[model samples]
Structure formats: C-alpha cells, structure tokens
Target: MKLNAKGALLHRQLYVLLKEQIVTGRYRAGDLLPTQEALCQQFSISRITVRRALADLGEDSFIQNRQGVGAFVTANIGKTKHGPDFSFIGEMRRALKETTMQLLLLETQRCPAAIAAALGLADHEQALHVVRTRSQADEPVALLDGWIPCRFAKAVTAEALKTKSLHELIAGSFEQLGRVAQEVNAALADPIVAQALNIEINSATLKIDRLVHNREGAPVHYVTVLTAPMRTRLVMEVAADDIDGYNVGRLLHDVQQPKAPRRRQP
Candidate 1:
C-alpha cells in the first residue's frame, strides 16, 4: 500500500489499513490474505516491512499464519461507532447498571478562588460543594468535585445526588440551563485523588474542567474531574468537514495504490 510520508511509518500505516479492512468485515475469518510478494508489489514496500505488519496483526489476534501457506483472517474485532453527543453525564447514566456513585461530601461552603472565578463568584462567596467517586465493575474510575452557586443549593440534596447525576439535578432545577464549556488536560494524580481512584500517586490521569452556563450566558457551576486513565477513555467522532483538509477517500486510496518508482537519471 502507498504510505503517506507525512503520517506514520510505512509498516504501521500498512498495518492500520489492513486492520481496518478486517475489522470492517472486508476480510472475513478463514479468508487467506494476499501473498507476501503480492502485498509488497501492490504497496511498493519491502518484504521486511510487510512481514512486520503481518506479524503485528497476528499478535493482535486479527490474523494467523500457517507455515508453507499464508496469513488468514482469524478474528473480527468490531468497533462501536458513536455520534456527536459527548456528554459525560449521559455516559455515566447509560452505564448505571454496572456503575455506582459514592457521594463523599455535600454541603455549603466558601468557594475556592479558582472555582469561584470559573463560576463568577466574588471572594468568600458561598457555594455548594459536592465530591463524589464513581466506580465501574467494582473498580474506582473517577473522582468528581463540583461547585455551584448558593442560589441552586436548595435544589440539591444528598439523596438526590446519590441517585441522579449532577447535570440532571442542575437541569431539573433551572429552566435556563444552556451550554457547557469544557476543557480536558493530562495531569498527574495527587495523593488524595490517587487514593480515591486506587492508582499510584503521580500516575497519569485525565482531568476535565467544565463551566456550565445558563441560556442568558451566566455561569452556574464549575466542576473538576480526575479519572484513571486505564479505566476511563474519551472518544470523540467528528465529521470530515469538521476536521479541516481531512479527506477520507484520499487517505484510503493512498494506501491502496502502489507508489510510482523514481525515474533513473539520464
């Protein structure tokens, strides 16, 4: 396959292309793949590179190679496609059957400086503080800390929080709830957060901060989330147009055709 020079290594690119085809059912189980020589000639790659790609596929359980024969598709790993809705709260709710939320703290307290700024609160202003831990399949996954202005405090209760997600409570109580401004970053877990998630201190974690706004553009809540990287992964699917200059067809075609050989000097 033709490899994109600006992208991953030639072998890696070839592996990904073949993997996609197998996973998408273009190549079914028990179907033998093209010979090594045929693959090399079709992709304009070296035998070593083709072998490496095939080896990786075999290791991943996507294919199996028989001596004196060729590699055959052994398994099909199907992927679940998701749409634009990337609501964290929605994800938690859908997995409620296997997930549990433990409310650690819920009370009115003076908002911290950083959280106060995010919620547009004056210094020392009162805010409702909520801390919780979420677990899936009995493994701790995330630690959530939320701060909402005292105006909405009356609508929240320990019992309500235990049953409903924060977003649910907020939306139910306020008619003006609108968009949420969210930011995600890679951070190291502190001692407290690490202990809560059952991870080692200083381990990598995904930190997400969100500022919920009302229809009138007023900030209503600020939330911080620390999640175990192994247990929590974030996936987003966007349209080709949403990603500037991303041509899916061209990418696939590039890997399907052989690169033209360079002309010799006259």
Candidate 2:
C-alpha cells in the first residue's frame, strides 16, 4: 500500500485496507493483527499513523488492542445469520413476520426544518410525527421517527402503527408507493436513543434516512431509523447484469483523460 503525505487520507487508507481484510475473512475473529512496527514498515508510515488507524478500528468494535501485545479481531465482521436485507421493499415485506413495532409518540407538530424540506413542506408547516421502537423476539432493535404531511396525518393512528410498519400505513394512504430514496450512515447513539435501545451511550448505530414519493412523484413522507450495530446488519444484493449497466467502461475512459486547467480571470 502507498502512503500519501496527506495525514487523514493515509490514515483512512490503512484503516480501510485492514478492515477489508478482516471483513473478508482473511483475518478471522481472534486472529492477532500485525504489530505496530510491522504495519508501519508495510505501509511506510509512522507509528503514530498506524496507531490512529488501529484506534479507529477499535472504536468501531472491529478489533481489540492489548498493551505489549498486538490487536486482535473482536467480532466476525460481515457475518450475520438471517439478517434483514437492506432494501426498503424487501425489509418491509419481512417486517410483520420478523418484528413488531411499539408506538411511542404520535402527534401533529411543526415539522423540523430538515425533515420539512425532505417532505416538500413549507417552513414551520405542521406535520404528523410518529415515533416507535421496533423489536424482534421481544428485544428492541431499532427506533423509527417518521414525518408525514398534515393532509395525510389523520389516517395514521397509534393503534394502527402498533400493528403495521410505517411503509404499510403510508401505502394504504397513497395511491401508489413511488420511488424511494434512501441513505445509510454510521453514527453513535445519543443519550436518549442509547437508553431507548438499552445500549451504552455513544454506541455504534446505523442511521437510515428515507424519502418516499407518491404515484405522481410528489414527496409523501420522510423517515429516520436508528439501529444498533450488534443487533442489525444491512445487506444489499445486486445482480451482475445490473452492475454492468453502470457503464464502468465509460467511467474508466473519462477517468483516464486529463482535464485542461481553466484560464485565470484578469
């Protein structure tokens, strides 16, 4: 691996490479990681940089560092038994059988600025907000917060939310469930969320943000879901043909071409 002078980039590169190795089973759980000096020589980086990368891996619960001894893999990364598929449509279909939702809060309130924008609502517009905890086999696994426009708020009720997934409720209210845009990000749980999930404060969590559109392509609702890392794993399956449609050949050609520098203004 080549080490760049850029400190942050260099650190991240080493971390990602080691993480990939561990996740791909090249370095199995309980396997000892290379010593700091060895890693430094392999990457041609300083001990400080190696330590920084290792620290990040430790914080994320991928490895454990022992004083005088080397770091060892703590958990089996990329391995889960019957984990929920990361696709929204797939997960919703499995929700009723695999999990249950307990309604925590249901009320009409002024939508938060960020959520309002996602739902295509004017600033300060009132919206229906619902909060619930999703559990599997009686163990809390996720916390969901959803916001829908006031026009459709009346249709959602506490009783209904307990028996149905948010998507199911939304689908019943809309003519069609149009395209859904989703983003998954890594985050640490705040105090309130940590307590709700019965996990330690600042524990690793997955934050999924979704925006649903109606049949006419109008925004329908915005949702944010938080899940503990230990209890949930997100997986996405894509076919080879689907990957080929990305036009990687064209992208590689564009990447190989150099760009001319823009002329400076007088």
Local distance difference test values of all predictions, in order: 0.78, 0.79
Candidate 2 per-residue lDDT over residues 1-266, each given as its tens digit: 66886644677779878987887678988999999999998989999989999999999889999988889998657574676565656677687678877888888889889888888889968898888888997889999888989776655787766666566676673336887767778888999899778887877799988788877787777988899876776676665675653322222232566789999999
lDDT digits (tens) for residues 104-158 of candidate 1? 9998999888888888889978999999898876899889899989886666888
Q: Clashes in each model (backbone N, CA, C under 3 Å)? A: 1, 0
List pairs with backbone clashes in candidate 2: none
Query: Can you give the lDDT of residue 82 in candidate 1?
Result: 43
The window of 10 residues in a row where model 2 has the poorest summed lDDT is 245-254
- For candidate 2, the lDDT comes to 0.79
Model 2: residues >4 Å from true position, as ranges? 1-80, 83-87, 173-175, 238-266
Off by over 4 Å in 1: 1-89, 95-98, 173-176, 237-266
Q: All candidates: CA RMSD in angstroms?
A: 11.6, 6.9
Error of 1 at 177 (Å): 3.7
**The best candidate in terms of lDDT:** 2
